[model samples]
Target: MDEENQQAGPSAAAAGPAGRPAKSELVDNQNFEGQFKFGRLVVILSALAFTLFVSFLDQTSVSTALPAIATDLNAFETISWIGTSFLIANTSFQLINGRLSDIFGRRTCLIICMVLLAVGDLMCGFAKFVVPVTVLAGIAVFLVIPQSPTSQGRMRDKVKMIDYPGMFLSLAGVIFLLIPISGGGTTYDWSSPLVISFLVIGAILIIAFIVVQARFARHPTMPFRLFERNSAKILFAHNFISGVVYYTDLYYLPLYYQVILDKSPLTSGVLILPLILGFSLASAAGGFAIARLGRCLPVIRTGYVLWTAGAGGRIAFGPGTSIATIAGCLVVEGVGLGLSMQPVMIALLSNTRKEDRAVVTGLRNFLRTVGGAVGLGIAAAIINNVLLQHLPAGLPRAAASQLSVLLDTLPVEQRGEVVAVYMRGLHCVFDGRAAGDGA
Candidate 1:
């Protein structure tokens, strides 16, 4: 009887490893560790790192080269459009990529994106004309990015439902808003026909997109379910706000260095290294820390304080701030950015099931990018308005326009007086001062 009962007990507890007991395996996370798991983590990190590296290099390296390129190409006015065009195209594509990533896989889409990036780089390196290079670069971006969600594996179940509607809304909203702002200060008159057209089109599309997402799609991309939680909304806002702060810092610091500190263009560009490098490093660190600590809120709060202080602090202190102060600010901001960014990414993932990760990521990225675009325009507007205000009262229109023309002609020193005037005007405009009628 005992022997028979012992054999019967074998099936009593729910199955575990070999039917020992189910609870043991459930309690221990040990089985989850292995080469395969670690390898997947590595691959994800590698992909993300590559994405950041390529994008950063492209943005930063160009500033150093823009002057030289413009001088040789005689496209001073055209140069502004280069950045504007890139932003528009990049934003537009980011929206679509999120949807495509869901249909294809993230890993596959990313590889294609890298290929596009490689081609863009090749064209930029070789092309004499900006048009071909810029257009190709845009196409490359379109091919490379897929707007799918990132998974810390939270919203896994909702994956299949994420696709088009929300993306179109975001794309339209960004395009319309960005066109005017990007052009308002530079490429076209603030009120130019081109700018107006973009604004109008963008607005109409965004409104239509929202309607489509709400009324049409079976599984609309924007996960309204997540927003019902306060934390997710906070996280989204943090990403958006942080981006704005970052863009402002990135745009202005170089101007301050070149204009106020009297550094060369190369020097100005180099001076910004600490901030960008700090951001990249901090992001990696933050991601690691989140995995280890498993405490999301504190890390994010700390990050917020540091980034805000670093960015907004300068607004209060002014140009006389010390180098050490600036460096400290950069490091702190980087830390904050790392802390907030990764955790938010994690939060969105944690909040949802595994499937919805791509959708969440796409939505988050779109908002953050939009915030960045807005920040760029705000910074530009500040500089432009300042220049307009500071313009000396009776400067003859002819001389002023000549000065503007010269400034637009070529790079410093390599460019004749015309280039010099343009550089001076750039400084004057950024510094929030107008050219003296005397000069």
Candidate 2:
């Protein structure tokens, strides 16, 4: 129907004797290094793994420090912005980053992303004011620059270039939608004039961005056409299904610890280790297992099933639940996440050429990350609504608001009781489960 649409097919050149990359994807079916240079491969993988660790650590570490940041900046309303800003920056440009890598080269983009991420982290660490936070966040978003690589039988290729226009439109679209949603209740009233105006503005921005991409943006970041890649489709499937729970973990786990268990910010950070550590170890393992097994279908299915189970456990950990019980659930869920997460990625990569990998992988990761954020937001709202309905009259009125909000308003003494309410509320939120079930 459109010119971009007509040109949207996978690279016709993918059918190398050694590999079958989709159209426009230049996977030369040739392994220049021959027979896996174990030493060099290990070094390369280690760098990638280190990057993953730093990226993930930055992502999670902030949760632990949020309270301090909030207190220091007096940014009670902008609390959500801290996280939302980064997500918007990181996810919005993911497709663009990918296209850029495919067109220019992955190395340059990745290095740039890493440096930008480092700068962002440094800025976040030192951020004293809201403007600094926003500015730094905008700059730090350069971290998610890797493109998704397509896997092939017996070989793989990475993206050689990057797409700028596609990425900009997509980034704009994500930011436009999230600006209002992220700040809805806290910064502005959901139904208020300004919030509603922002909502309208975001919609228009996204609509405009999409129209431009579909018509213009050659070498688009998302290449809406590239969804034709089977791996791309499956990658999304993995994120969507896994995302429901992956997001829930990041969304509710912290609140559960701080709000229910009444743990200090530092302590809350320690508590999430089982989940984060478990996932980190398992993801690496999953990659190895997938590489050995050379197929992803089984791993994907298994991970999905386990993830659902983990979600069940998380949904069940309520106010009265045993600390040990919650911890146990985290370990189990972490293992499941680890086992499934990397394997699916490997499986997806297994089917793609190296050139497309960065963008595709970035897109997949972007969706999953956003999914987690959205899930967290929904869980927060649900928990808040439930708490409001169930909070005993004796509790402070301010204590009855959303967890993040309430934490900011009340002093430490009153927070314990509020935390108990959150735990119990989450219990009920989890499909009518009681927090006292563990007792």
Candidate 3:
């Protein structure tokens, strides 16, 4: 009886013919030695992490260089496109890449993504316009990431596993949701029919997509069973909120250094290094903790505590805040980010059955991307609203409109007031993020 039960246990988690595992058995079953050589695992994960780092660096590193890029290219009017284009492409391609990874094998999809990302970055460095190049890079990154070890095999009939209907529905739904969130209050009015229509339509399509996944698809892109587990639902929410906190600090801290502290762009980048250092250390430590302990929850909770402390601390920042203070806060934020990021991903993968791993990976990324987009949009709205309501009436439209680049150039008498306006806007953005962290 005991032998029969033991045999029955692993069989429940075993992969079906199409390469997906049943939801009943989600625990790790493969022996470490049979699954991966330590050396090979190190090499593959290192490469995959580097690929993700480059993708993130492409996003975060550009802010410090933006002023120079705007001046050099004479494209200040279109500057927002550099980031927005990337976000749209990155968010949209996640599901498609997840499906492709399932069909073609994780290695194949990753290689294609890396090659495309490399080409796009190289082109951008050569003074090419960034929108298209960055869009392609974003698409590559969304595609090139790793899948679970169990998801590595090639299927017999890849065509059957590709769920075209679900893919289209998901893509359309996400793009619709993202378009309004990205463009509202920037390119169009928040209340405009263009925005409202897209929001409603996007919500409906997403609902429809979920229904179809539950009822119809021969091979549902997102297996409904994955979220049936309560823990998975909570994890997805955590990922979304983390995205908000991560990008808020990343985008704004450099501005604080440049605008409030009177540091040059190069200097600002250097100053942010402590935070990056903390992130690297904690990320490595967190990964080790997961491997050794075989659990992620403890590390994840500790990360939240640190992240909240660091993010909330920044709310007190003003024009006179010290670089030391800012640097310390950044370090805290970085450590929190590093600790939380990898463990959550590891946790998500661990909870999912083998066949669902790639899809869950894509879903995790999609939520993060959406969370980032929403956070940035809210920050932009707050900044713009504050600037409009508070800026001195006498300031030139050009200077007021392009506040970041023009603040230093304004007359000495007005420069301080302009700086104050910017400082207020930054405070709102930071405070909002802190509140999110606490929640």
Estimate every model's Cα lDDT from 0 to 1.
Answer: 0.59, 0.61, 0.76
Q: For each candidate, what TM-score against the reference?
A: 0.72, 0.79, 0.87
Tell me which of candidates 2 and 3 scores higher on TM-score. 3
Q: Report the C-alpha lDDT of model 2 over 1-439, residue by residue, as the tens digit.
A: 5665345434434454444454445442323567668898899778877776776667776656665677778875566666667656665665565555554455666788788777776766776775455445444444543444323332222332233445555666677676666666545567888768866876776677677667875445554654768776867776755654565556456766666766777777778888887777777777777778877767656655655566577666666778788777777678778888777777666566455566567667767766655655555556656666766676644322235545656767666667766666676555422121111
lDDT of 1 by residue, 1-439 (tens): 8876465442332245553434311111113345467779889667776686676666655544554566678775576566556666666665556555655456767888788788888887777878557755764554453333222122343354355456657666776778787767655677778888888887888777778766776556554665777877877886676556555555556545544444566776776777777776777777777778887777777766666665544443334557777677667666666767777788877775444566667667666666766766765655455445554444322222123333433455433433233344444333321111001
lDDT of 3: 0.76
Cα lDDT tens digits, model 3, 1-439, are: 8876566554444556554554322323333566878899999778888877887677677766666666677666666666667777888887667657766666677787888888877877775576677777777766766755323233545565677888888889988998788778766789999999999999999999898889998667788888988989999998888877676666667777777777787887888787788888999999998888878988988887888888888988988888789889989988988898878888887787665777788888888888888887788778877877887798743321245566657888898887788889888888888888777
Candidate 2, superposed: residue stretches over 4 Å from native: 1-36, 134-165, 229-234, 291-293, 350-355, 392-417, 428-439
- By lDDT: ranked, best first: 3, 2, 1
Lowest-sum lDDT 10-residue window in model 2:
430-439
How high a TM-score does candidate 2 get?
0.79
State the weakest 10-residue window (summed lDDT) of model 3. 22-31
Best by the TM-score measure: 3
Candidate 1 stretches greater than 4 Å from native: 1-44, 138-173, 189-194, 219-223, 291-293, 316-325, 393-439
Cα RMSD of all models vs. native, in order, equals 9.8, 6.8, 3.9
As for lDDT, the candidate ahead, 1 or 2, is 2
